[model samples]
Target: MVNYASGEAKGELSGAEYRRYSRHLLLPGFTPESQRKLRSAKVAVVGAGGLGSPILQYLAAAGVGSLTVIDADLVDSSNLQRQVIHSEAAVGTPKVASAAHAVHALNQAVHVREVPEVLTPANALATLAGHDLVLDGTDNFPTRYLVSDACEILNVPLIWGSILAFDGQVAVFFGDEGRGVTYRDVHPRPPEPGEVPSCSEAGVLGPLVGVIGSTMAMEALKVLTGLGSPLYGRIQLYSALTGDWTRLDVARRAGRAPVTEIEDLVETCGFPAVEASGAAPVRAEVLSPAEALREAATGRLLIDIREESEAAEGMLPHAVNIPKTQLMEFARGERAGVGPLSEVGDLHGAILHCAGGARSAAAQAELAALGISVANMAGGYVASVTLRP
Candidate 1:
């Protein structure tokens, strides 16, 4: 039988630790024993952003013996809104480094390991191995699916949290024990790329991450110490607007094949693949920001597909703000020649750009299929501004 509650041998708490965790020690079911289990626990947290900020802080404060923080992105000024672990000084630095510093500052005794690389199929298993528990705070579907599959294969408990707009969701998936369901049990397949707007497009409430991350952290303590029931086979959902939390049960899919290996999900969860009919792949005509700007100078129209809020910050010299939804509706004929693009004749040869270009690329693909010829500004507005002379 697999021992789900324990891992490495427990360690004795020091005087300072006892003082530091006196509140935890005083709980009836939780005493020195539980604190010792925590002291011996090793945890890996992927994506030290909004959710990760609180999860790492609470876990480190609770004295998780070792923590591995993995992320490849650098801190941006925009992240300061919800990613509380990083400060103004951390801008432009690696997220893992910033997160590690925060963890150490909170509790110097807790050992922190920083993996400053994007977790990939080649490295997910090796990077995640040896950790007793893994918390996924990554924002994208591809990374979320990757982490879940890796954890399922490793037989480690995974606490997953997602936040968007005024809502959030948290779930615990334990493939080897405690209800025996993985993330795939709830989400059999990823949604089509761009089907669900990102937090960037949808916009999230800042403190919403705190509520979800703290819940995940609380669930982590329960799983580590066996102090309470974890959210196995169920997901907890939170709504900031409604001020309510709801729980929904999830069951393992019957006859679902187990994840034996990690594979790149870029095609599955990110970009679309070629059709089986051997039709030409629908790829966007891409041009670098600088190249697109030169074309725009000559007469090619440049359209900013980012939301109005994002465009408010800045935009290209001669770009017209047409949000992705409005432009796509016009392309698909959903707007019936009545939307923002209705007045603009001849979309052919025009260029579409977003914050970093991913959305615009997706929009370009759909638009191309509908016979709307357009180009995608490869680096989008951010890159265009940087290269603008």
Candidate 2:
């Protein structure tokens, strides 16, 4: 844990640092003292994708002393759309390594620790400990929860940001500090699987990641240097399409228990759906893409739960388009087979698919809980086409 107490010896700024951070030092309240704080601060950044790109870049440029970059994915060509930190040459390289190299290039004075592994409950605490602050740029629900929980248990200050489809949100959580707000205070539980589309499915504006990531980085500097009011207990929301920004206040839930331990939520918040309650767990039936096609040929209804935008491109031969959000609404009894699914009365024994099959597979539990007897097409449309016989 970082010693937040005052009167700690401040680090001295070098002649080059003075020249580099001249603008920051010139700020009214941000003096050489603040610059020194930044120089001495250590921050842990989770993820090296879209949001992580800008956060790492800005923070590194600002001269943060040590950065621990954690990510497990390799750079894919598809990531070039919004992940600005990595270059065409970085494709197939580990994201953390690429991020570390980018950081070193941006500010050689800053130390970069690259952790090329997924942050799991088993290692999250040990990995994040000792940093003055932690930032979460991860895309999934499970990692978001895990990071927040680890911060809570470790009593670290945390800044979190998320982006989806031209929209972004930023919030600061200081577990056991100040207002004591945590991410769980804002999101009581992860959204149900497949209720929301991922960036791959829904698509996001490239600049929106910058807007949110930079905002988070700004909040981090403020927290580190006491420059201004941090966004603690407040969440900033931005919409690129509308060019609008809004703020929401978050309060710690009264009587909510503080997180004492991390729990494995791979099934609940990962690809699989939340388990159904009963004498036995109701699991979604999963079928390979080939099997799904075969089943579809045998009169089983095939549904493609990708967004309308994606379905506009193409879909399986026998698959009906019933966007995931709308399908979940129907599963939750919000509507009675409205819209494109209006004519499809029964979902029983239907085979659901998405572009890569994860989204449709994630919808399994909810549909299964309703006794719909649906099977998810593992690996989705891509596999269906590639593996077709």
Candidate 3:
């Protein structure tokens, strides 16, 4: 929804404005005035992982005045495949700071702010307020809802993206846009209690994130500059396996609870339904590949939570190699209805492994959150190799 204020005021801009945004101004039908508007646009993105990588990269490349990134994670070696915003040197650095610096590297003219904290209700308002757009690259439901409800209350647009195994969704929620729909419009209730798996729980395809994230950035551009058709009130799905694309036009839910604040959203959605926040953490059990081999023989599930490509290199003899990106969707597919108990079925036992211990541990914990019981292979895939001569 274009909300250009009427009457009139398209004044001449400054020299730096012309110089800083000269390229954009040079485009046909995109005058210096439009460049200035883009140069003045500010956006805040939650989470700096898979989707956030390309989202931030493109926004900075476009010179979107200011970019603020909020994330409490640290870059891991495993993330190198997908979370492209960070590099080898940034492996141990804070994600927000690392991502901010990465954006600055792309365009020094753009101001970057790093909020190195988990987005919570208290700071949700401050984090979102004053920004022209908020991007949701967050991984979990609790945080996703936090950003969504905050945008809804502030009456701003939220550019959202989600990647599950191989399928992904992109949509723009504009509580302020004309009778627009919010996140609730698409999937009213969170996935079945045990059905939604997370990024760490399942792995993601590195470039796949770029595909969805860059598109989200483009959507942000459309919403910010009124340049093209917005994704608001619309949903786009991309599938890697089939290389198919689908778009769904959506509308608001009938008689849904009015969303005023993040808290109301928490209550309305019955989120934190099982209290993942305060629940005691689960312990991940790790094992050597030899140890894993022994366990797999007992009809146990060996889940490889690495990215799709990485898993293809090689996995345990009987491992079920569902990449992280497909985890959430996998849980909801027929597998959950017929697979092992620890996974789709009520399996008696399971083992989780990743390239490194961190990703596997993360995957283990995320699945455990969905009530999956499994042991984490401590040393990860590298620990599984046979000794060479």
lDDT tens per residue, model 3, 115-183: 888788889898789999999997667677778888888888999999978888899998863366898
lDDT per residue for candidate 2 within 1-389, as digits (tens), equals 11122212355777877899999988899888888888788899999999899999999898787888999777876678889999999987888888888888788777788888889988999999999999999987888999999999989999999999888999999878424899989889877666776776677888889899999999999999997899988999898989899999989999888898997765666456435445356555778777888888887888888888888987777778988888888877787865445533477678888876558767777666655567877657754654443
In order, candidate lDDTs are: 0.82, 0.81, 0.72
lDDT of 3 at 207: 78
Give the per-residue lDDT digits (tens) of candidate 1, residues 119-220: 999999999999999999988888898999999899999999999999999999988843489888888888775677677667789999999999999999
Model 3: what TM-score?
0.67
Model 2 misplacement above 4 A: 1-10, 177-179, 272-279, 282-353, 356-358, 370-389
Q: What is the lDDT of residue 334 in candidate 1?
A: 68
> lDDT score, residue 5, model 3?
22
Per lDDT, the best of the predicted structures is: 1
Q: Better model by TM-score, 2 or 3? A: 2
